[model samples]
Target: MTDFSEQDLSGSSFDRVDLSGSTFRGVDLSGAVIREVDLSNSRIRAAYFDGVRMHGVEIPDLEISGEVVRLVVNGIDVVPFVEAELNRRMPERALMSPTDVAGFWEAFGTMDRLWGETTDLARTLPPEKLHEQVDGEWSYIETLRHLGFAHACWIGGVVLAQKSPWHPLDLPWDEAPVHEGVPWVRRIKPDLHEVMDLRRQRRATVAEVLDGITDKGLGRRVTSATPFLTDATDLTVADCLRVVLNEEFQHRLYAERDLRALGAG
Candidate 1:
C-alpha cells in the first residue's frame, strides 16, 4: 500500500508483487518478469523499458501523454512505446475481446500522446495565434470547441444510452454544441503552462470515460435517440463506441491541420 516512485530498483527481481498503482518512473522494466501482474489504471511516465516480462497480466488500457523512449517489436523499432506495449499484450478474450479492446487501448495511447503534442503547441501559442482565421472559417479555439461538442454529442449520448434503458439510435449532428470558450480555446488567452496542463487533464478524463467500457457492455444494445429520428433504435455498444473513436480520428485530423496553419507548422 506504499507509493514506490522514482526509486532505483535496478537489478531487482520483482515477482508476485502489487505493482498496480505503483509508478515506475525512470525505472528499467527490461526483462522484469511478472506473474499475475495487474497494471490496471497505472501510469508509466519517464520510465525506461527495455521490455518487461508479463504473464497473465491484467493491463487495463494505457493512456499516453508524451515523449516515449523506445518500443522494440521482435527487435524492430516500432513507433510508440505504448502502442507496441498494447500490441504485445493483444490476445484473444471474450468480454471485450483482446482484439477490440487492444484496438481501443492502442488508440487511447495515441490519443493521449497527440493531446500532449497539440496542447503543448496551443500553450506556447498566444490568442492571436489561436484566434487567427482561415478562409473565413473557425479559429483554432472554434475548431477545438467543435471537437469537444462532437465528443459530447457522439460519445456522451452513446455512453448515456448504454447506461439507460433506452439506448441511442443516432447522433444529432445538426444540433450539436459549438466550440468556444474552452479553457484551451478561450476568448481570453491563458497562461501557456496552465493551458497545457488543463488540456492534458481534460483529454485524460475524456479518454478514461470511454476506456472503462467492457466487451459485454459493448455487445449489448443501447437505445439511441436523435432529434432527426422519429423513434430510437437499439444499437450495439461496439457500434456506438466506434462512432466515438471515428469522430475523434476525424476531428484530430482537422484540429491538427488548423493548428499547423496557426504557426505550429
Candidate 2:
C-alpha cells in the first residue's frame, strides 16, 4: 500500500493504470471531470454525488438506495414512483403519513417497538465497536444523536414553538446551514449510554406531544420559526410530526445495517 498523505497531485493524469481493489479513504475528488472511465463493478458507500451530471453512460443493473431528493430519469421524475413502490412493499410505511391523532399514536408505538429491537441488537456488540463507522457511514452513537436532533427541531421547536431546542450533542445533517444556537459538534465522541440517555429524553418529549394530539390539532399550522429548518414558513403539524417519524424509521434501518456489519467484523 502506498501512502500519499499531504502530497499534491494536481493536474496528474493516469491512463491505463491498474487501480483495481485500491482503497481511497478521506480522499478529495471534488471538481474533477472524468471521461471514458470504466467504473464497472465499483462499490461506493456514503459518498456525496451532488450536482453531478452524467451523459452517454451505459448503466445496467444499477441499484441506488439512500435519501434521494430529485432523481430524473428519461425526462421524468421517478421519486414518487420509487416512494410508492417502497410503501407498497412495507405496508407499515403508511403509518408515517397518518391523518388523525389515533393513527399517529399507533405509528409512534410501532416505531418505539422497532427501535427497541434495534437497540437490543446494538447492545450485543462491543461498546467500542458501536462508535465505529461502517462503510464510511455515521457511527451508531452519531445516528442516535442525529435522531435526537430531529426530534428537537421538529417536535420541540416546530410543534411546541420553542425558539431553540437543540441539545449540545445534537447532530445536524452534513449540508445543513450553520445556524446560531444550533448544535453541530461532529467531533464530540460521546459514550453509547450517554447518547442513548439523550435519545430517551427526546423520545419522551415526542410521547408528550403524541399524548396531547387531537384531530383538529393535527391540521393546525406550526407557526414557530427556526433557522435550523430550510424554510421558515408555517407547516402543518401533521407534516412536521411525519418528518420526525420518518427520520426515526429510516435512521433505525441504517443503524441496524451498521450493527450487523460490526458484528460480522
Candidate 3:
C-alpha cells in the first residue's frame, strides 16, 4: 500500500500496472494517454473532463451525472436527445432555456410556483426532519440556503455588482471552492422560518430584476467579482438567470424526493 501525495509524477509511464482500489486526490491526469484500462466499480467525483476522446470502449451499466455538453457518443451528440426527453417528461424543463423576455418571465414564474408548493409540502414535516439528510443528499433547509446563494452569486454579485452578496446562512454547493468572506457553514441548524425568510428576500430580489428586464438587458454581458466566478466574463444576464433557474428546479426535485422518503409529501 504505497502512498503518493503532492509529487510531480509528470511524464511517467506505467504499462500493465495494477492500480485497482487506488485513491487519486488532487491528481492531474491531463494529456495522459492510456489503453485497456478497467474502471469498473470506480467512483470519480468533483473531476473535470474536457476535450476528452475515447475509442473502442466498452461502457455499459455506467451512469454519469453532471453538467454535460457536446458529449459525442457513437457518432451522436446525446445531449440534445437527453434534454428533449427531460423536457418531455418534466415539461417545465423546457422553460429553463428561454429566448425572450416573456419566456424568462414564464420560467421564473414556474420556478416560483413550484417552489411555493414544495415549501408548503416541507412545512408539513417535523421541524427536525427538515434538517435531516436523506441518502447523503442536502437537507431541505440546505437546499433552500444553496438556492439563496445561487441567486446572490448570479444576480446580486454578478448583475448588481455587489462585492459580497452572501447571507450568513448562504450555503454553496458541496464541491464549491473555499472563498474568503463567503458563508459555507454546514452544521448550523437554522429553523425553517429563518431560512424561509432569507429565501423570500432572495426571491423578491429576483422578481424585481425580472420585472424590469428587457430583451436587450438579457443579452448584456455580466461579470462577477467573486473569486470563484471571476473568469465568467462570457456570461450574459440571461445566462446567469438560467443558472439560478436550473439550480432551483433541480434542487426542488431533490428536496421533494427526499421529503417523500422522510414519510412526508
Candidate 4:
C-alpha cells in the first residue's frame, strides 16, 4: 500500500510488504537495498538503479517493461533475464473481473477524457525527451502509432482471427501475414497525421466489429506462449473482442501517462 517511490530506501527492509501494482516512474532509487521485494506488478520504468543492491530478492515473473534497465550491483553487471515470451504475462488477465470488457473500457474512456487536457503537451516536450534516444525515445504521437500497429496487426490479425470469424480481408498494414500466426513484416509507421487519423478511425470502427462478436471466439489458442494457455484454454468471440479492447486501451493509458509527464494533463 506504500506509494512513496523516490524516498531514500538505502537502509530500509521489509518482509511480506506488497509493492505490486505500484509505479516508480523516473524516480531515483540508485542507492536502495531492495530485499524480499514482490515487484510482481511493479512498473519500474526508466528509474535510476545505478548502484541498487538486491538481497534475497524474489523476482518471479518480473516484467521489466522499462526503457532502460542496467542492473549493476557491487559494481558488477547482472544480466537481466530475457525470454521470447508471447507476452510477458498471461493474456487472459481480462477475465479477472465479472465483466471481461470492463477493464478495457475503463482504461480507454479515461484516456479519451484526459487526452484533451494535454493535447498541447506534445508540442511543448523537447524533441530529445520525446524522440531522441533509439530505444528509450518515443514521442507521445509515435507511441500511439506503435501501439495501434501492434493491435491492428498482431493481436487483431492473429489472436482475434484465429478465435473469431476469420474475415481474411486485405489489411492496410501488411500483405498476407508471414505465417498463420505472425503478421507479415510491414513497416506500418505511416505519416504522423495519417497515423493519428487512422488510429482515431480504427477506434471508432472497431466498436461495430466488437459488437457483433460473441464469447466463443476465445476458444482457439491465440497467445504466443504458455501459462496464458492455462487460463485461455477457450474463449468466446465476445471475450476475444474484449481482449482486443483491453489491449488497445492499455496502450492508450500508456500514451496518456507520457502525455501527463510533460505537464500536458
Models 1 onward score TM values of 0.45, 0.74, 0.90, 0.41
Model 4 sits at a Cα RMSD from the real structure of 15.1
The TM-score obtained by model 3 is 0.90
lDDT of each: 0.50, 0.83, 0.87, 0.46
The best candidate by TM-score is 3
Tell me the spans in candidate 2 whose CA falls farther than 4 Å from its real position: 1-56, 68-81
Q: Kindly list the per-residue Cα lDDT of model 2 for residues 1-117, writing each as its tens digit.
A: 676777788778888787777776656788878888888888876678888778888898798987798888877889999889989987777788788888888998899888888
How many residue pairs in model 3 have overlapping backbones? 0
Q: Candidate order by TM-score, highest to lowest?
A: 3, 2, 1, 4
lDDT (0-100) at residue 134 of candidate 4? 30
Best by lDDT: 3
Give the per-residue lDDT of model 1 (tens digit) for 110-161. Answer: 6566656766776566656776766555565555554444444444445454
Q: Write one digit per residue (lDDT tens) for candidate 3, span 117-207.
A: 9888998899999999997889999998888888898888987788888898988877677887786686798999999899889988887
Worst 10 residues of 2 by lDDT: 225-234
lDDT of 1 at 40: 61
Candidate 4, residue 98: how far the Cα is off, in Å: 6.5
Give lDDT tens digits, candidate 4, residues 1-265.
Answer: 6577556655666677655555555454555555544455444443445544566555557555533346654566454432213224533333323243444455445545544444455556654454422324355555655555544544444444533222222122212224464332343333445555755755654555445434443344555322123344355434444554545545445665665665552
